[model samples]
Target: MRLRVCGICIQNERILLINHSLYGKDTFFWSPPGGGVQFGETATEALEREFLEETGLRVKVGKLLFINEHIEAPLHAVEMFFQIDSFEGTLKTGEDPELSAEGQVIEQVQFLSWDELTQFAPNQLHRIFSMIGSLDGVFHLQNYIPGQNSGLEK
Candidate 1:
Protein backbone atom coordinates (compact mmCIF):
# COMPACT_ATOMS: atom_id res chain seq x y z
CA MET A 1 0.00 0.00 0.00
CA ARG A 2 1.13 3.57 -0.65
CA LEU A 3 0.70 6.49 1.71
CA ARG A 4 0.02 9.47 -0.52
CA VAL A 5 -0.49 13.06 0.62
CA CYS A 6 -2.58 15.33 -1.62
CA GLY A 7 -3.20 19.03 -1.32
CA ILE A 8 -6.43 20.92 -1.97
CA CYS A 9 -5.88 24.43 -3.28
CA ILE A 10 -9.14 26.19 -3.92
CA GLN A 11 -9.42 29.81 -4.96
CA ASN A 12 -12.30 31.76 -6.44
CA GLU A 13 -14.38 28.59 -6.56
CA ARG A 14 -11.81 26.85 -8.75
CA ILE A 15 -9.67 23.91 -7.77
CA LEU A 16 -6.19 23.05 -8.97
CA LEU A 17 -5.84 19.65 -10.56
CA ILE A 18 -3.37 17.61 -12.56
CA ASN A 19 -4.53 15.68 -15.61
CA HIS A 20 -2.67 12.41 -16.03
CA SER A 21 -2.98 9.86 -18.80
CA LEU A 22 -1.38 7.19 -16.70
CA TYR A 23 -3.32 4.40 -18.36
CA GLY A 24 -2.93 5.38 -22.01
CA LYS A 25 -3.30 8.14 -24.57
CA ASP A 26 -7.08 7.98 -24.30
CA THR A 27 -7.43 7.33 -20.58
CA PHE A 28 -6.89 10.01 -17.96
CA PHE A 29 -7.31 10.69 -14.24
CA TRP A 30 -7.65 14.18 -12.84
CA SER A 31 -6.56 14.48 -9.26
CA PRO A 32 -4.96 16.90 -6.87
CA PRO A 33 -1.17 17.17 -6.95
CA GLY A 34 0.43 14.56 -4.76
CA GLY A 35 2.47 11.40 -4.58
CA GLY A 36 3.96 8.79 -2.26
CA VAL A 37 5.42 9.78 1.09
CA GLN A 38 9.03 8.70 1.25
CA PHE A 39 10.55 7.30 4.41
CA GLY A 40 11.52 9.85 7.08
CA GLU A 41 9.41 12.54 5.43
CA THR A 42 6.30 14.02 7.10
CA ALA A 43 2.98 14.23 5.23
CA THR A 44 3.21 18.01 5.13
CA GLU A 45 6.69 17.82 3.67
CA ALA A 46 5.51 15.35 1.09
CA LEU A 47 2.62 17.57 0.07
CA GLU A 48 4.88 20.59 -0.29
CA ARG A 49 7.38 18.66 -2.39
CA GLU A 50 4.62 17.12 -4.50
CA PHE A 51 2.93 20.41 -5.24
CA LEU A 52 6.19 21.96 -6.35
CA GLU A 53 7.21 18.95 -8.37
CA GLU A 54 3.86 18.50 -10.10
CA THR A 55 2.45 22.02 -10.25
CA GLY A 56 5.44 24.36 -10.02
CA LEU A 57 3.83 25.98 -6.99
CA ARG A 58 5.29 26.27 -3.49
CA VAL A 59 2.52 25.62 -0.98
CA LYS A 60 1.99 25.39 2.76
CA VAL A 61 0.00 22.40 3.84
CA GLY A 62 -2.80 23.28 6.20
CA LYS A 63 -5.43 21.35 8.15
CA LEU A 64 -6.26 17.80 7.26
CA LEU A 65 -9.57 17.54 5.47
CA PHE A 66 -10.03 13.95 4.42
CA ILE A 67 -8.51 10.51 4.72
CA ASN A 68 -9.37 8.20 1.84
CA GLU A 69 -8.45 4.57 1.35
CA HIS A 70 -8.10 3.16 -2.12
CA ILE A 71 -7.52 -0.60 -1.99
CA GLU A 72 -7.70 -1.80 -5.53
CA ALA A 73 -5.23 -4.51 -6.63
CA PRO A 74 -2.35 -2.47 -8.06
CA LEU A 75 -3.46 0.95 -6.84
CA HIS A 76 -3.96 0.72 -3.10
CA ALA A 77 -3.26 4.08 -1.51
CA VAL A 78 -4.18 5.69 1.78
CA GLU A 79 -4.43 9.32 0.76
CA MET A 80 -4.32 12.22 3.17
CA PHE A 81 -5.92 15.36 1.85
CA PHE A 82 -4.97 18.69 3.40
CA GLN A 83 -6.00 22.23 2.76
CA ILE A 84 -3.42 24.52 1.19
CA ASP A 85 -2.82 27.40 3.59
CA SER A 86 -1.02 29.47 1.02
CA PHE A 87 0.85 29.31 -2.27
CA GLU A 88 3.13 31.25 -4.59
CA GLY A 89 4.95 31.02 -7.93
CA THR A 90 3.58 30.45 -11.40
CA LEU A 91 1.45 27.38 -12.03
CA LYS A 92 2.73 25.08 -14.76
CA THR A 93 2.45 21.46 -15.74
CA GLY A 94 5.31 19.39 -14.29
CA GLU A 95 6.86 15.97 -14.64
CA ASP A 96 6.51 13.01 -12.33
CA PRO A 97 10.03 12.11 -11.21
CA GLU A 98 8.97 8.54 -10.50
CA LEU A 99 8.35 7.92 -14.20
CA SER A 100 10.74 7.95 -17.14
CA ALA A 101 10.70 10.57 -19.88
CA GLU A 102 9.12 8.18 -22.36
CA GLY A 103 6.57 7.18 -19.73
CA GLN A 104 5.40 10.67 -18.84
CA VAL A 105 1.69 10.76 -18.03
CA ILE A 106 0.77 14.25 -16.87
CA GLU A 107 -1.04 16.00 -19.71
CA GLN A 108 -2.42 19.22 -18.23
CA VAL A 109 -2.53 21.39 -15.09
CA GLN A 110 -5.20 24.01 -14.45
CA PHE A 111 -7.77 25.38 -12.03
CA LEU A 112 -11.22 24.05 -12.81
CA SER A 113 -14.54 25.49 -11.70
CA TRP A 114 -17.71 23.61 -10.79
CA ASP A 115 -19.28 24.08 -14.21
CA GLU A 116 -16.13 22.95 -15.89
CA LEU A 117 -15.95 19.94 -13.62
CA THR A 118 -19.55 18.87 -14.36
CA GLN A 119 -18.74 18.41 -18.04
CA PHE A 120 -16.67 15.32 -17.36
CA ALA A 121 -17.88 11.98 -16.10
CA PRO A 122 -17.44 11.53 -12.35
CA ASN A 123 -14.76 8.89 -12.84
CA GLN A 124 -12.45 11.40 -14.43
CA LEU A 125 -12.12 13.44 -11.26
CA HIS A 126 -10.51 12.82 -7.92
CA ARG A 127 -12.78 10.76 -5.72
CA ILE A 128 -13.48 13.70 -3.41
CA PHE A 129 -14.74 15.68 -6.35
CA SER A 130 -16.98 13.02 -7.80
CA MET A 131 -20.10 14.22 -5.99
CA ILE A 132 -19.48 17.76 -4.97
CA GLY A 133 -22.80 19.57 -5.26
CA SER A 134 -21.18 22.95 -5.55
CA LEU A 135 -17.81 24.58 -5.09
CA ASP A 136 -18.77 25.41 -1.50
CA GLY A 137 -19.70 21.78 -0.89
CA VAL A 138 -15.99 21.05 -0.88
CA PHE A 139 -15.77 22.56 2.59
CA HIS A 140 -18.14 19.89 3.87
CA LEU A 141 -15.97 16.97 2.90
CA GLN A 142 -15.46 15.73 6.42
CA ASN A 143 -12.31 14.01 7.60
CA TYR A 144 -14.15 10.80 6.94
CA ILE A 145 -15.96 9.64 3.83
CA PRO A 146 -19.26 8.21 5.24
CA GLY A 147 -20.17 5.47 2.75
CA GLN A 148 -17.64 2.70 2.19
CA ASN A 149 -17.49 2.64 -1.59
CA SER A 150 -18.67 6.15 -2.43
CA GLY A 151 -15.11 7.47 -2.45
CA LEU A 152 -12.67 4.73 -3.27
CA GLU A 153 -10.27 4.67 -6.21
CA LYS A 154 -12.12 4.29 -9.48
Candidate 2:
Protein backbone atom coordinates (compact mmCIF):
# COMPACT_ATOMS: atom_id res chain seq x y z
CA MET A 1 0.00 0.00 0.00
CA ARG A 2 1.10 3.58 -0.53
CA LEU A 3 0.75 6.59 1.73
CA ARG A 4 -1.07 9.56 0.21
CA VAL A 5 -1.94 12.98 1.54
CA CYS A 6 -5.02 14.85 0.36
CA GLY A 7 -5.96 18.45 1.02
CA ILE A 8 -9.52 19.51 1.81
CA CYS A 9 -9.80 23.01 0.44
CA ILE A 10 -13.03 24.90 0.79
CA GLN A 11 -13.67 28.40 -0.49
CA ASN A 12 -16.87 30.40 -0.72
CA GLU A 13 -19.03 27.34 0.09
CA ARG A 14 -17.39 25.21 -2.60
CA ILE A 15 -14.68 22.57 -2.56
CA LEU A 16 -11.83 21.90 -4.97
CA LEU A 17 -11.88 18.59 -6.80
CA ILE A 18 -10.47 16.85 -9.80
CA ASN A 19 -12.25 14.75 -12.38
CA HIS A 20 -9.82 11.94 -13.04
CA SER A 21 -10.23 9.18 -15.58
CA LEU A 22 -8.04 6.18 -15.07
CA TYR A 23 -5.51 5.63 -17.79
CA GLY A 24 -6.15 2.64 -20.09
CA LYS A 25 -9.38 1.99 -18.24
CA ASP A 26 -13.01 3.01 -18.45
CA THR A 27 -13.26 4.57 -15.02
CA PHE A 28 -13.54 8.03 -13.54
CA PHE A 29 -12.78 9.31 -10.03
CA TRP A 30 -13.71 12.58 -8.41
CA SER A 31 -11.38 13.31 -5.58
CA PRO A 32 -9.58 16.06 -3.70
CA PRO A 33 -6.10 17.35 -4.59
CA GLY A 34 -3.61 14.81 -3.38
CA GLY A 35 -1.06 12.16 -4.29
CA GLY A 36 1.54 9.74 -3.01
CA VAL A 37 4.00 11.10 -0.46
CA GLN A 38 7.49 11.06 -1.89
CA PHE A 39 10.33 9.72 0.16
CA GLY A 40 11.95 12.28 2.47
CA GLU A 41 9.07 14.73 2.08
CA THR A 42 6.70 15.43 4.93
CA ALA A 43 2.98 14.72 4.51
CA THR A 44 2.22 18.45 4.53
CA GLU A 45 4.96 19.05 1.99
CA ALA A 46 3.51 16.38 -0.24
CA LEU A 47 0.01 17.81 0.10
CA GLU A 48 1.25 21.32 -0.74
CA ARG A 49 2.99 20.08 -3.86
CA GLU A 50 0.04 17.95 -4.87
CA PHE A 51 -2.44 20.82 -4.48
CA LEU A 52 -0.36 23.02 -6.75
CA GLU A 53 0.05 20.31 -9.35
CA GLU A 54 -3.53 19.05 -9.30
CA THR A 55 -5.53 22.25 -8.65
CA GLY A 56 -3.12 25.06 -9.47
CA LEU A 57 -3.40 26.30 -5.91
CA ARG A 58 -0.71 26.78 -3.28
CA VAL A 59 -2.06 25.55 0.04
CA LYS A 60 -1.08 25.63 3.66
CA VAL A 61 -1.90 22.29 5.30
CA GLY A 62 -3.82 22.39 8.55
CA LYS A 63 -5.06 19.79 11.06
CA LEU A 64 -5.38 16.15 10.15
CA LEU A 65 -9.02 15.58 9.38
CA PHE A 66 -8.97 11.81 9.06
CA ILE A 67 -7.15 8.69 7.97
CA ASN A 68 -8.61 6.34 5.39
CA GLU A 69 -7.54 2.93 4.23
CA HIS A 70 -8.78 2.90 0.65
CA ILE A 71 -9.31 -0.60 -0.67
CA GLU A 72 -10.10 -1.40 -4.25
CA ALA A 73 -8.60 -4.21 -6.25
CA PRO A 74 -5.21 -3.23 -7.70
CA LEU A 75 -5.13 -0.14 -5.49
CA HIS A 76 -4.91 0.17 -1.76
CA ALA A 77 -3.86 3.45 -0.23
CA VAL A 78 -3.57 4.62 3.34
CA GLU A 79 -4.75 8.16 2.76
CA MET A 80 -4.34 11.07 5.06
CA PHE A 81 -6.84 13.89 4.74
CA PHE A 82 -5.76 17.27 6.04
CA GLN A 83 -7.50 20.60 6.13
CA ILE A 84 -6.16 23.25 3.79
CA ASP A 85 -5.99 26.26 6.04
CA SER A 86 -5.63 28.72 3.20
CA PHE A 87 -4.84 29.00 -0.48
CA GLU A 88 -4.21 31.53 -3.26
CA GLY A 89 -4.21 31.15 -7.04
CA THR A 90 -6.54 31.07 -9.98
CA LEU A 91 -8.30 27.74 -10.29
CA LYS A 92 -7.50 25.72 -13.41
CA THR A 93 -7.20 22.18 -14.68
CA GLY A 94 -3.80 20.65 -13.99
CA GLU A 95 -1.91 17.52 -15.09
CA ASP A 96 -0.70 14.39 -13.41
CA PRO A 97 2.99 14.09 -14.23
CA GLU A 98 2.97 10.40 -13.39
CA LEU A 99 0.92 9.64 -16.47
CA SER A 100 1.93 10.12 -20.08
CA ALA A 101 0.54 13.06 -22.03
CA GLU A 102 -1.78 10.77 -23.94
CA GLY A 103 -2.83 8.95 -20.79
CA GLN A 104 -3.39 11.87 -18.46
CA VAL A 105 -6.14 11.09 -15.96
CA ILE A 106 -7.09 14.60 -14.87
CA GLU A 107 -10.04 15.59 -17.03
CA GLN A 108 -11.17 18.71 -15.17
CA VAL A 109 -10.63 20.80 -12.08
CA GLN A 110 -13.54 22.49 -10.37
CA PHE A 111 -14.91 24.03 -7.20
CA LEU A 112 -18.23 22.39 -6.41
CA SER A 113 -20.91 23.12 -3.85
CA TRP A 114 -22.20 20.43 -1.49
CA ASP A 115 -25.37 19.89 -3.48
CA GLU A 116 -23.35 19.54 -6.61
CA LEU A 117 -21.48 16.65 -5.03
CA THR A 118 -24.64 14.69 -4.30
CA GLN A 119 -25.34 14.32 -7.99
CA PHE A 120 -22.47 11.90 -8.37
CA ALA A 121 -22.77 8.32 -7.20
CA PRO A 122 -20.81 7.34 -4.12
CA ASN A 123 -18.53 5.11 -6.14
CA GLN A 124 -17.60 8.01 -8.40
CA LEU A 125 -16.27 10.11 -5.57
CA HIS A 126 -13.52 9.62 -3.07
CA ARG A 127 -14.83 7.62 -0.12
CA ILE A 128 -14.22 10.49 2.31
CA PHE A 129 -16.73 12.64 0.49
CA SER A 130 -19.13 9.87 -0.48
CA MET A 131 -20.41 9.58 3.09
CA ILE A 132 -20.77 13.06 4.49
CA GLY A 133 -24.22 14.49 5.23
CA SER A 134 -22.97 18.07 5.15
CA LEU A 135 -19.80 19.79 4.10
CA ASP A 136 -19.27 20.87 7.70
CA GLY A 137 -19.07 17.19 8.68
CA VAL A 138 -15.85 16.90 6.79
CA PHE A 139 -14.12 18.83 9.53
CA HIS A 140 -15.44 16.35 12.09
CA LEU A 141 -13.86 13.29 10.55
CA GLN A 142 -11.03 11.72 12.49
CA ASN A 143 -10.49 8.04 11.72
CA TYR A 144 -12.11 6.30 8.78
CA ILE A 145 -12.45 2.60 8.01
CA PRO A 146 -13.35 0.69 4.87
CA GLY A 147 -17.17 0.88 5.01
CA GLN A 148 -17.58 3.99 7.15
CA ASN A 149 -16.89 6.47 4.39
CA SER A 150 -18.97 4.67 1.81
CA GLY A 151 -22.36 5.03 3.52
CA LEU A 152 -22.45 1.26 4.01
CA GLU A 153 -21.82 1.56 7.73
CA LYS A 154 -20.51 3.79 10.48
Candidate 2: tens digits of C-alpha lDDT, residues 42-64: 99999999988888888889999
Error of 1 at 60 (Å): 1.2
- Going through the candidates in the order shown, the clash numbers are 0, 0
- Global Cα lDDT for candidate 2: 0.84
Which candidate ranks first by TM-score, i.e. highest? 1
Candidate 1 lDDT over 1-154, as tens digits, reads 7899988899888989999997798988889889999999999999999999999999988999888887655567788889998999999999999889999899999999989988988778877877578877776787756434433565
Candidate 2: worst 10 consecutive residues by lDDT?
Answer: 145-154
* Candidate 2 runs further than 4 Å off: 23-27, 147-154
Candidate 1 regions with alpha-carbon error over 4 angstroms: 146-154
Best by lDDT: 1
Using all chains and alpha carbons, the TM-scores for the candidates as numbered come to: 0.91, 0.89
Ten-residue region with minimum lDDT total, candidate 1: 145-154
Query: What are the lDDT scores of the predictions, listed in order?
Result: 0.86, 0.84
